[model samples]
Target: MPHLHDDALTLLALGEAPTDEESAHLDLCPRCRADLGSFRRVVTAARQAGAEEPGTAAAADSDNPGLQSPGPDVWARIHRELNLDDALRNDPLASPNAFAADAFDPARPSPAAHAGTPQGNVRPLAAARHRRTGAWLAAAAAAVVVAGAGTWATLRAVDPVPGPEVVASAELSPLPAYSDTGSAVVDRLPDGRRELVVTSTGDDAQGYREVWLLAPDATSMVSLGTMEGTEAHFELPADLDLSRYPVVDVSDEPYDGDPAHSGDSILRGELDL
Candidate 1:
């Protein structure tokens, strides 16, 4: 059987229960399971980011600020950004009936009709289903894009404008038995907090990867944090002495319940302050 479509997976992530067939396929298919997990995580993250107290809006807007609808050009901007069909250049919200009429005009010949087939042979029910599905898919995609834009705008409104600046950096070289090469940089945010940003070509290790700062003598090391992907950011302790621990090391760690480094260093570099 074919894997479930993205629309079906999205529905499942949004709390729609799967059918028996879908459930069976999900249980047996690792790829589908991973995709579903990713969709669920995205949904969960969006919900968490947008969640707010019920009365908070009322408290914040005590003056009852008047709401203004977006201008007519908003749809044009969205269409341009998404590179949507030329047929959808018009604002559907402003003239929904006309949009609907244009989308489902009976005079518009179907593909089967266009191919010189008899119009009478075309099943009206199937055509209707296809039209409905296409409309719903378009609406869903537009909604997702609009929601993403809104979320981005909200985040930009709250986040610092200038962002973080790099303070120091290092070029990581792969150690023996490894071929991965990478770089690490220390970033200082506007709030005076520092973070270590690491990026690498990545390794094919069976275990997890961890970031560490080590002294020149290899006598002391501090675990920054575990890295998930090829790149990660770790918050540096406010009082951490970068001069004392100038060496940045990335190691492959096995799940042995031991917090100590496995000593299987993949990439190592000395930071230039």
Candidate 2:
């Protein structure tokens, strides 16, 4: 059997009893069951957040403050920022007609016109309920969009923009026996922090790879870090002078716990700063 539609699931979440076929499908299909559960959770959360208890309408109205509508400027800003259509510039919660302008018609016959008929009273109530539900949903969706846009703007204002400058770069060539060739770049970030990005491609050696910064004379060196794949980023110490350690080297190291350069350099290059 086909899965239930989203509308059916939403109606179920809104407390409408499921039909026998729907119940049977829900019992058999795990995916539909999970979807229904998710919709139900959202409905429950919304109700808990905004719904007042039954029989407490008068007391609640007297004691608790009602939700305030956002200012016109809020909707205007949301419209400008989100580039929404001009038709949606108006706040949906400000008026019921905002979403369902034609929901009610003065020319249409009223339920009283067909008072003697069986469906006269029921039809009007059902239609009214449907319109109210649809209008509420539309307003709720618009409110969510506005809130999300506001949140995005707030986050964009607070988050820092990354500006990386390549202070030095090197073209890593295969040393002698190894066929791996790659490149390395030292980037200076906006916050005065430095990092080395390396990328290489070749046959996978038996041992793991290690990165290092070496002196021009190949006498002194410092291990930046280990490389697990073809690309990696290693943070450079603030105190480490790049001029003194201008050579970048990638080596294949064995599992031996020597903590020293294996001297088996796969690729090496001198940075041009």
The model with the greatest lDDT is: 1
lDDT for model 2 comes to 0.64
Estimate, for each residue in 1-273, the C-alpha lDDT of model 2 and write its tens digit: 477776566667756677777898776553466467656665655444333322222224555555244455655665576665443556654564544443234333444445564543444423443333333343344343233233324312322233466577777889888788777878776698998988787647668899999999999999998997888899999999999999999988999898999989999998876
Q: Where in model 1 is the C-alpha error above 4 Å? A: 1-160
Separately for all candidates shown, the number of backbone clashes (residues 3 or more apart, or on different chains) is 0, 0
Lowest summed lDDT window (length 10), candidate 2: 50-59
Clashing pairs in 2: none
